[model samples]
Target: MRPAILAILIGLLAAVAPVAGGATQRASVSVVADLIERAAPGDEIRVPPGVYEGNLVISKPIVLDGNGAAVFDGLGKATVIEVIADGVTIRGCTIRGSGEDVTGEPSAIRVTAANATIDSNTIEDALFGIDLQEAPNAVIRNNTITSKDLDAGRRGDGIRLWWSHGCTVEGNTIRGSRDMVFWYSEDLRITRNTVADSRYGLHFMYSHNTVLEGNDLYDNSVGIYLMYSNGITLRGNRMRNNRGASGYGIGLKDCDDITITGNALLANRVGVYLDNSPSSIGSTGLFESNMIAFNEVGLLATPNTHDNVFTRNAFIENEQPAATHGRGRLVSNTFARDGAGNYWSDYAGFDLDGDGFGDVAYEPRSLFGAMLANEPNLRLFVHSPAQQAIEFTARALPELRPEPTLVDSSPLALPPTIELAIVDSGIGGARMGVLAVALLSAAFGLVAAMGSDRRLTAQHTGGGA
Candidate 1:
């Protein structure tokens, strides 16, 4: 009887243990705004897969997780999510349609506090996708943002951060916006993003210690606009196809201690435009190891901008001059051909010796280039015979040409080449030798056939064979 009683007690205890252990602290609420309002700090709000069409304001630290693919539509009027608290994590939600307004500040998500993580979200059809004001130490990662309103008066931006510092914007795709500006921000890292079809892809105003890397910027009015910013580094970016009335791939205005390297600037109106303000003087910049090709102007260093270095760069196949306004150090650059100078398609000088450097120092600037600089419409005569005649006469008489500025003595090395011998016994060379022998045999057969035909005609006519 005692053994049976002990067995019954053990079975009852096993059955009751699960009920006690499975009792968890759960506060599952389904209402959209009410659930967020009633949730306390450290609470988790699991939003189911549904449409929540209202403005969300989180004032406490919590985790807002979309259980499935949830969406929050702002209906083109107000901001979608406004965060006033720190340490809030919003992830995996679709926020859309915070369109432009003449009266209100329309942004999909706006964060005011710090230590926020906004990741893996889709924001679209908004005046501004994500607007952060005074928010520091935020990680905005893997967000797809697109704003369709890009007219002159619409005033939309994909990601506009004002006075926000220590932000990391990584792996975001921004499109169809205008003037995506970051003003008074510091220690910002924008990397691995695709920004296009906007007025300005990444515009920094009075921002310091910013690093932009591995970004693809194209089809914008300005790829990267820097105004009154300092200590910026732009590396491994590709800027192309920024062609319009007033378009530039990269425009630097009144910025200092900027280092731009390993960038590809292709087919823009002005590849890199260095503008100098009245208050800006003795500001130094470095452009190194960049491929500035097929642009109207590769480097346009306007007057009053001094002490810039363009070193180890490839300026290839520019329509006009390689560089405008000669005030910088151009060192070890490739000019024309596979030589030490740049690979200028219009180089008429000769490389007399076997050394790769050209004999004559190729002056990339010309009088016509300067004339077109003053009157950009004159560039329409680039292919005209009149321009060709001027170029020919200028080559013949150096006195009529513009004064040449020597930038660099040695440029980067050319691409590697492969040589093949026609008569070698190797497979590649033997194949060429076989083709040559076949051609020669066919020629010899044609000659023999003509001689035999003449001999047969003479023999038939009783002439000596």
Candidate 2:
């Protein structure tokens, strides 16, 4: 009877071997978990090539190198990998299948430990790509991240640093996600990252003393927005084609001691929008050597924005070079410092003395610009004859001429020499094609409508005659 029972158990094990050895590979999955349990701290675990089911928690310091062939799939449940141990390194792996429930805040990789290096990982189909909560001194580099196939607003952030300080996020490409945000995370060195096709490319709140250099942010709603963040240095960044509602290439609200230099703000709705920035009295903001070009409004500021210095920058070919949000004067902001002012493409003044500086000051005092400042809907008439008539009437009647929005006392005769190296993500394939078709269709329709309106006006005038 005992031999009969043993024979029955062996037959059951043989029958299940085919299932375990096939697609599920449950034995390899258990082997990894068992090995992790048996390994000591600081062990270098090189996971073999396989699609292992992941709900992994690395609570001890170790180097988990996947060699780029190991894929950890979470089966669309909670976080795939959670690192609670400091000094753990997770790299060279593909991590996916995080739960899509936003309420649970599911993520592919959640690191709550300090000094973790999450590098060169391909993370996709995850709600939140990589979330670092209270994880200081983390190095998140060279990771390609994308969120789940939810709406842009519903998709979680591609990379979020919540109260994580002294972190370096470099050389990462993030797309189709909500934002790459830093909340209360300070002392960050965020450089050389490309973020596109999402909401805010980079959003910072209460994060101070950060240096953002060589970042490319485009095709999004707002390129970079800093709220209540102070002592930030934005240098050598390219912001382009961000034309959503409130599409500012760089926006600063209630921020202080901000330095914006050597950056490119191109083809946005507004190049830069400032609302009470340098909010603290006696605080200073600096804008110099930057190229602000081809935007609807180059610089849009609120009534109370004050004490910002602008020098040696180029403002080129914007519809309105500078304007106020509501009723206010821009005399509070200094357009010239140290005998140098910005270069204005629309400056009608001459360099009579060959000094490379305009003899007359560049003051934007257009009547239509003032009207658009108070009532923004007038922008629909941009580039139309109606806009030209309004400006002509203002020139004919001096009383209609509004005060200058801001004056560049010593405007440069030539555009300032500033170069920004923008990274091409090569991911704007079908979306750009569709956008081009829509823009061409709208332009042709506008031309046809304008021609019909002119013909009708002429016929009505002839009938009255």
Candidate 3:
């Protein structure tokens, strides 16, 4: 609870002002919803360490400061905390035990209020962790939310923002839920969070002008997926090992003006899946400086995909570096910008002049591979002698060349080096410094303890008096 409160305090100082209107009519509540019901609007309710039974509602513009000591248990029948008023603040509490009824869609905290803040709370065993419906500019930060271990269909989103425009969701670790869903939410800034073992770490539908950065999304069905969204920027994120049924580090469908840069996508089925992305010829999607490695397919695009550009990204050790479905070649997408292309691990082209560009065009897929891409059924016989012979024949015969999946006119023979800078500003830098110092101190203490143990062992073993 102390650790949880500390996390909240770090986020709170920036989001919320110092508790104003000092102690005018502060009330204390224990296991009673009536206290909150009876409190006046804009009043402060101090909840001490105890289990508060039944459902609670914040109908007035007020502060429910639990300080990580109070636990609101729903007793398995209702949504635990419901905020119905504007400017409601629910902070530093453990809220759990939401109803599992499919119709109810119960959540640990459900907010219908604008400008509400839910911070520094540990929420567990909930159907939905925090459901915000039309709650514009709501800030959810520094909360740890875990949902019930149920099927993806039954498990609701850890935090759902429906029509919650201009909201800021940051520094919350979420797991065991359907997804962190943003439906029709725009201008959102989601950062510094970790999500694992979920359906989709982040799911966006009709969400635009969203910025997602410094987030770790792993072991999910898909790390991040967007459908029919535009103006999305994903940076400084790590997405790894999400080899689920539809495993993709990031899946884009008809998305436009996407800027996915400075991100790492590792060990997923498809590092990035682009389906009709950059929707129109006029729209553009830029993939820049991303590390896409150790995945089944580094970049999988539909045959008709166009208006998408990939530049300065590294494709390493993927089963298929770049692939297209129903394809001879991807005619529309550009692999290189200004004669500088991505670094492909399998590119054997030479850079003789040391200009960092391959003299020959680096093509990731051969003619046979392109055929297999269009006709995926041929993949089953990939290692068979017949398939190998056909591939060799295609290589031997210049006339039988398959269309290039990715044609990099100037691919980098050597891997392009990109230095990812960690944010060292405000609380982030302070936190990193504290962590480094703590780690060094711990290492020194361990060394001293080992030395002492060795001396004691020598004395006990009769090697020394």
RMSD of each: 14.4, 9.6, 10.6
Give the range where candidate 3 is weakest over 10 consecutive residues by summed lDDT.
21-30
Candidate closer to the true structure by lDDT (higher is better), 1 or 2:
2
Candidate whose lDDT is highest:
2
- Residues 419-450 of candidate 2 have per-residue lDDT tens digits of 77765547767988999999999999888877
- Residue 66, candidate 3: how far off, in angstroms? 1.9
lDDT tens digits, residue span 260-320, model 3: 9989999998999999898866889999889999998898888788888888999999878
Query: Candidate 2 — which residues are off by over 4 angstroms?
Result: 1-30, 423-465
**Clash tally for model 3:** 2
Deviation in angstroms for 126 in model 3? 0.4
Writing each residue's lDDT as its tens digit, candidate 1 over 295-366 gives 887766565555666655667767664554544423222232233344344555566674655466556546
